[model samples]
Target: MRIVGDGTRALNFFIDTLLVFLLAYAGFKTWNFYVMYWGYPAYNFGWFFFGILFVYYTFFELVFGRTPAKWFTYSKVVTAKGSRPALWQILVRSLVRLTIVDMFFIPFFGKPLHDKLSGTVLIEI
Candidate 1:
């Protein structure tokens, strides 16, 4: 198993972000229609978008060991020893990924805070 480099991880993040954005857009349109027709007040879209991202990353990673972006990039989340990570590890990784430091430090460090803390790594299959 080859460790995925910074470039591939960055690309995976970009693709995942784009996918989340598209999903948020669809959700926003639907919510907008409901608000317009039902006369409900507009809710905070930022929170909704964040929730979508959290669910997307956590659920997919837990279920498949990778998100859609990771799948396309031929990368996967694995334990430091190159085995499939446990559920708790995946959860920790996903939650840690939401932090600001993880976002900023990942590109330069090649491993995000999430991966380090969870004892997991991203590997190119």
Candidate 2:
């Protein structure tokens, strides 16, 4: 099924990656952690990042259907059924994103694919 959304998910990826990094750096600087990994001073900051992103994406994607970055890319999250996500739905979506299980694989299927597998969507808007 050719999902007619976000023709430039590729471009969104590139832009979003840089934006996340920059935001992370800003977070670090704001916290006065020059030695931190861009605002992550904890040793297990991977988990911290996971946790934070979980909250951010879950909360926003559920309430607003997009993160700040997704908004910048003209994309919004949705359920696979093309409806607004519920709490559990958003939780599941955040889990997929936080784990990076989707981005971790070959064929390089990003958020949209993971959302599809998890019965969610990232629509162009």
Candidate 2 lDDT over 1-125, as tens digits, reads 23434455666566655655665556545555644546535434444445456666667777787777777777766666777777887777667665545655425654454565667766676
- On a 0 to 1 TM-score scale, where does candidate 2 land against the true structure? 0.64
Candidate models: Cα lDDT each: 0.85, 0.62
Candidate 2 has an lDDT of 0.62
Worst 10 residues of 1 by lDDT: 103-112
Tell me each candidate's TM-score: 0.88, 0.64
Could you give candidate 1's per-residue lDDT for residues 1-125 as a string of tens digits?
78988789889989999999889888988898989999877877786677788889889988898999998999998898988888889878778867778867666766788887899988888
**Per-residue lDDT for 22 in model 1?**
89
Off by over 4 Å in 1: 107-110
